[model samples]
Target: MTLKSVIFDVDGTLADTEKEGHLWAFNRAFQLWNLPFRWGVPLYRELLNISGGKERLAYYLAQHPEYHPLSNDEIREIYRLKTNLFMERVRAGVVALRPGVRSLIGQCYQEGIPVGIATTTNYDNVETLLLRHFGVQWKHMFPVVVAGDEVPIKKPDPAVYVRCLEQLGVSASEAIAVEDSAVGLKAATGARISTIVTMNTWTYHHTFLGALAILTSLGTTQTPAYGTGPDGWGRYRVTVDQLRAWLV
Candidate 1:
């Protein structure tokens, strides 16, 4: 495979957005709605096993029927509020690209290797986060962005990854997916794309069985990544050249 493209998952792979970004936003929205409960870190971690935010909320509610029985419309309303809050958090600069993320993405852009995003998050969240970090021309930097609502289903189903690969004009064998959790790994690999797993606080315990590489972070010159992979190219940092060499 020539490694024609690099597809990234937004939430944890690009930035650690679960704890402070999405979770906080969800909790804040719940508070505003005067919902009886809030999603603490531990419970949120388990809820993350569910894919999309709306689906996660629905699953949580279904699991605990004792809470106020909100109709589907009410659930959507809560998620809408949460989404807005998440975008606000992004605009406020609460999140940052993970170590080596900008460097790697820059390398891909400069090298003319197409980079895309396949995420179960909404498009607004994606736009807000990337726009804040990459500026207004972020869309040019990441041309193929397949959000959760765009596809028929979320991660573990491969719909998002399939759509991303289609838009990027690359076959699964010619692209690599960078993801943070087992759900994402399955989605990428399910599409026959080789994947790299970058663990975060919420997903550190996930068993990434099919990932080509598993690392703590992408690694920086100051903060080197720690994990096992197919080659030594990721010894210091996961560079584009390293990915190319490893893929060969």
Candidate 2:
């Protein structure tokens, strides 16, 4: 299989957005809404199993029946608030592209390999994050961005990845997906695309049974990724050439 493109999952895969950025934003939204409940790190970890911000909130409500049930509109409002807060954090430089992410994206661009985004996060969130890191021309750099709003279903399902593959004009075998959780791995592999799982503090314990490789992080020359990989793979960094070699 030849790697003609690289598809990235946002949220945790591109950056460590769960614990600090997302969790904080959710809690802040709850506070502003005067909700009696707050999602702690541990509680949010359980909710992370559910993809999409609104879905996570709905799941949390389902798990705890004591809280007042919010209508669909209310849930959307909450998600909107949380997204705004998250974007503010991004503007404040609270989140960043993960180690080696920018370099790897640059490598793909330089090599003429199309880079795409397949995420269960809202387009606004993706837009804001990339604007801060990739500047105003982020969309030009990433030609295909299939965000949560674009898909009826989210991760753990193949819809987003399938749509992304469609837009990229590539078959599953021609693209490699970079993900950070079991749900993402399931989504990518379900699309029949090989995926690499990168571990973060929130998702390191989750199973990534079908991933092509599971690394601690993308890693830089100074901070090498620590994880399991195919033979001849290196941890010092995950470059475009290395990804292509893995496909070979």
Candidate 3:
């Protein structure tokens, strides 16, 4: 079936903002709270495989309770602090939207295809990205946004997807989702939406067994092969033909 709407995940999928984006922000929060832990990119990747920033914080604490233990209130407070730091980094122009992001969204807009975001990030981050990438009024461009905390649950739960479908007024089959991780793939799959995966920093090695297609970027080549990595899945180039081949 032809796609009626397009849904996207914000972080690794839309932008390569994780370098100093997530890890450093978490560190900033950690320092402010005097929490004796510093998260690395590898650990951050594993954490992202779960869902929701708050959940990730909790999960990390649970896994390594000996390192630092923070109650739910404390976790929320620090994460809020982290969120602020992250937004500050993003606002300072430290991160950039991945390749083809602008063109793909433009294509969607020009073709009258509704674009929506189903992300685990807070609405503020989403809005910041919208303003930074599209324009200050970018939030007005899309009709639907489903954030992590907005719904009763997070990714892999399907609640957010269902909510997004409801807000967009589209059937699951009529919408397509773009994801960057296996957890995201599972979430969209659980929601019964066809998904296109774009491998990112830490997600480059995971299996995308059920994605309609997997690629490096939305604007590259229609059929991207294993480029220069040992895994043969590290690089890809997606094209309109490839996108149309799947979306159509």
Q: Which candidate is the best by TM-score?
A: 1
Candidate 3 per-residue lDDT, tens place, 49-124, comes to 7787888888888898688577899988988998888888888888888777777777778787888899888898
Candidate 3 worst ten-residue window by lDDT = 223-232
Q: State the lDDT of candidate 2 residue by residue for 168-204, as single tens digits.
A: 9999989999999999999999999999988898898
lDDT of 1 by residue, 158-191 (tens): 9999999999999988898899999999999999
Q: Go through the candidates in order and give the C-alpha RMSD of each one to the true structure.
A: 1.2, 1.2, 3.6
Cα-based TM-score, every candidate:
0.97, 0.97, 0.89
How good is model 3 by TM-score? 0.89
Predictions in order: lDDT: 0.91, 0.90, 0.79
Give Cα distance to truth, residue 222, candidate 1, Å: 0.9
Please estimate how well model 2 matches the true structure, expressed as its whole-model Cα lDDT. Answer: 0.90
Model 1: weakest 10-residue lDDT segment is 227-236
> Comparing 2 and 3 by lDDT, which wins?
2
By how many angstroms RMSD does model 1 differ from the true structure? 1.2
**Which is the winner by TM-score between candidate 2 and candidate 3?**
2
